[model samples]
Target chain A: MDIQKVTVAGGGVLGSQIALQSAYKGFDVTIWLRSEGSIERAKPKLERLRGIYKSTLEALKTDPSAWCRGLTDSADVPAEKIDELIARVDAAADSIKLTCSYDEAFGEADLVIEAIAEVLSEKEAFYAEACPHMAERAIVCTNSSTLLPSAIVGYTDRPGKFLALHFANNIWKNNTAEVMGQPATSASAYQAVVAFARAIGMIPLELKKEQPGYLLNSMLVPFLNAAEALLANDVADVETIDKAWMLGTGAPLGPFRILDIVGLSTAYNIVAASPDAANPDTTAGKIAAKLKSYIDAGKTGVNAGEGFYKYR
Target chain B: MDIQKVTVAGGGVLGSQIALQSAYKGFDVTIWLRSEGSIERAKPKLERLRGIYKSTLEALKTDPSAWCRGLTDSADVPAEKIDELIARVDAAADSIKLTCSYDEAFGEADLVIEAIAEVLSEKEAFYAEACPHMAERAIVCTNSSTLLPSAIVGYTDRPGKFLALHFANNIWKNNTAEVMGQPATSASAYQAVVAFARAIGMIPLELKKEQPGYLLNSMLVPFLNAAEALLANDVADVETIDKAWMLGTGAPLGPFRILDIVGLSTAYNIVAASPDAANPDTTAGKIAAKLKSYIDAGKTGVNAGEGFYKYR
Candidate 1:
């Protein structure tokens, strides 16, 4: 199926990016917000993204490394053609429509990307409200980082078309879209979503089964947890762990540095939820305690200016 | 304690690198081999490393990105100074002394790096033979990847001076040296080892306690294990898993590629050793079985020309 009209549910960080990137790719895009306040908040985010996209495209003209895969075809675009692409960025930015009504957003959408809150009940209610308005052929994909599609597929009207299309942050640069489908999801719908991911200039990673955390977080969380365990167990300090990973694997950042970017609260909640964290003496419990101390002290993460390491 | 005369026990892959890198930094270096055959085998490896170092230095002269942090001061070296650096590489390669006698290698040595077989009995036997000849002031460090310093400190004469200084592969570029100390190890001795690691152009990651797998593998192994579990559980294929990680994290290589480089046998051994592998229904057991099938087909890793992916 040719996906032209795309409706993105919610106008948050990931949702705004999804809507903007879809429009940037020449898709007729609309962002479905919950309220006027959400629309007001989302407009500035879209504007900021527009400025970022313009500057990034400008950088690509002179520097080859500035080429964002999702924004352009390749790094070797002729200098003259770059101007056209930059114009397209502005055109795409201005083209996106915003609506608070479920009928207006999903009535004719070829694809409805649910990028709302991670709360289960919130997603269920949003799906139920939006389901009646969506087109019969429209495929719905949840852009959930942690929750599984199978758990929520029952709530959606078109279970056969419901799956997942998870994206990494900064979609234009780190252009990976993980397409996962539940057992009930139809093969045609899965293929269509994979093709749609490719149309948006993403490397689509297809998962055969529903895996929690998908592919990226499945690997990342365990790695971060191990590093946190080391710190809580007093095997090494923060800098030592970061330096070891960076110098050893040639990775740009270490676990703690990544945690700083990912936010300590996120790490704290994940650890606190683990069964092992119930006991204070366990490694998970100790990690939770450690993160709580940091969070309580206002050293939440890089966003707060400090976490494992101080950031200016 | 100032270290000058350095002895590297064994002439294996990492042992040769440690000896060469130390010699390159102008230390008086000796490599002790177990037999005449071992000396003959090590000569070619040193010759190969010399070629690599020369070409790498030559590359650094023209391309700033080619500057190996472990080999040179910085990428901004004057073009005229490169010839001198190249000359030093040749000189360092030619200066290394090789011997089979434990007394000849350990006598008057300021530091001894045990880089022999990973087997416990072999390491214990080596330390027993070399301890009598080692100088009273000499600090003994095991370059063991998996074994803890505390586990082998009892074999050495100087328990207070014993520690672990593990180096990553391709030490010229990946120049991380993890320094871990046991409770019996003196603070001064640990500090000396850290300084010595820096003197050899290594970033010393100091671990306060002896952690199995040190800093790198402690985090790396768990990350790889999670990826393996994903594949074993049939959630995703090898390439899908690799692509998700590489794109999502902006890492150069994915877990399977790293596993291929790390060798399937090593991964299999590590997995099979886990207590969970006793049950075939467990993820660890499935991963071990999958790795074993690949190993049985002679697809060991990149070295064997095939594993999860093929290399030219």
Candidate 2:
């Protein structure tokens, strides 16, 4: 139950972050990629994260507001201690192991986190392939944002040890890990994941039962949908909608800005999949069309340098 | 037409705020109350606002972050200039006129803001009575959060000059004025209101067309309703839901805290009015019941010193 050797199965955005965050917290972490090409792609992400962490730590030395709760325990870290923390970031960045073999990654891992693609079939195949290689005591968690844990639990060898541990993007700052478990998931396995989440400096939002979109997305998705509805229905323009919410609620970013960061394609897919999108006259249908137009023009999101608004 | 002598009908919370904010910006402001009791009720609210403005300005002198954009033009005010600003607050506080006579309040008014009761009949009655007293050039705006401008435009003397100018609570800080107009509203009137909103230190959110709930409420209501559904459906507790959002988005307050500020009675009424609330098994019905229980126990909101959480 004492999680130490952590293996993140995928070297994607979240996978690399989970590995680096674990290693940064002094855990023996390894990233399990499917091929050598994946490792090559993941290396630059880790290197970039190292620079971000070091510079952020450097900023924290003078500016207390620059303190990222996920990066360090305290905002008031002493000058010498900050240097030690920066050293730890470099050490963590250099020490994390990356490999293509599941047996090598999972055989000794006390905790194995599945952070591969979100497709259900791909996740099922991953669980089936890696089930035999994982240690008997190893607890497996999927960082799936959309899928329910119960749907994939059947593929894993130990249903009792499998659950979902979802993290928001930019885990270093927006550090919230929603730990959700299926009916079959054991109490011990759930508690262990909660403890591990805290140890890595994430606020664990424990869900009592299986909820679609978990807790964060359960609230965020609808809020975003409503904003999109306003835009699609021609009630207001993009800036007007964003400004109203920002000025009224004192929130830093508005829904459209969040959608841009979330990626327009992801938003499009979610909207398109909704039942209301079947009718061309419906608001959801209109929104899907609007998103598709932007996406067709190559304005995917902040990743593409544009979406709702342009970024420099 | 230029807006100079402004009359705010009904000296309620938002009405007093609008009147005070206008007076602070050197406008000739009058608050037309219904009776002597209303004048007495409004006097204390205006007095409290004066204290809030002075203390907030005093705090802004030392703490730059305490600057309320609605209270002043800039955060970088010189030490000596702050004394002048405080003096202006005192002068504005004493100069705001209160009256029960429609002729005295609206005969020479360039702009009349209706911030009376939300009840439709009360608003219609106020408009009918005040129409004869209002100046021929006066532009009238309703500050109703729920009722549309079009709904009450027929009762007014000049439908061409009628529109909605909505303000959020705590006008000194949360300073957004949503300007929405019906189809019959003149372009000149709309632009004048937008200019007046900016002149009073509010970021004007101009709606191109008539939309129920306007801009802020249209977006905020759905977002709050989604959070309420989650709570009603037993997906998560209030703290967990709030923590997940605040940590994930870096928002200052979560949906529940916002609900508490918005007042549970308002939330209950909105939920109860929803068509889905007819079914007891529905989420809206469940939420209505939940909010009613809190309201019945005298835990109305921050005003009542409690809602979802204790205020003081």
Highest lDDT: give the candidate number: 1
Q: Report lDDT (Cα) of residue A303, candidate 1.
A: 95
* TM-score, every prediction: 0.94, 0.93
Model 1 ranges with Cα > 4 A deviation? A59-66, A76-83, B58-66, B76-80
- Candidate 2: DockQ? 0.68
All candidates: DockQ:
0.76, 0.68
Best by DockQ: 1
What is the CAPRI rating of model 1's predicted complex? medium
User: Per-residue lDDT for B28 in model 1?
Assistant: 96
Quote model 2's iRMS. Answer: 1.1
RMSD of each: 2.3, 2.4
Question: CA shift at A176, candidate 1, in angstroms?
Answer: 1.9
**Fnat for each predicted structure, in order:** 0.86, 0.72
Could you tell me how far off, in angstroms, the CA of residue B105 lies in candidate 1 after the best superposition?
2.5
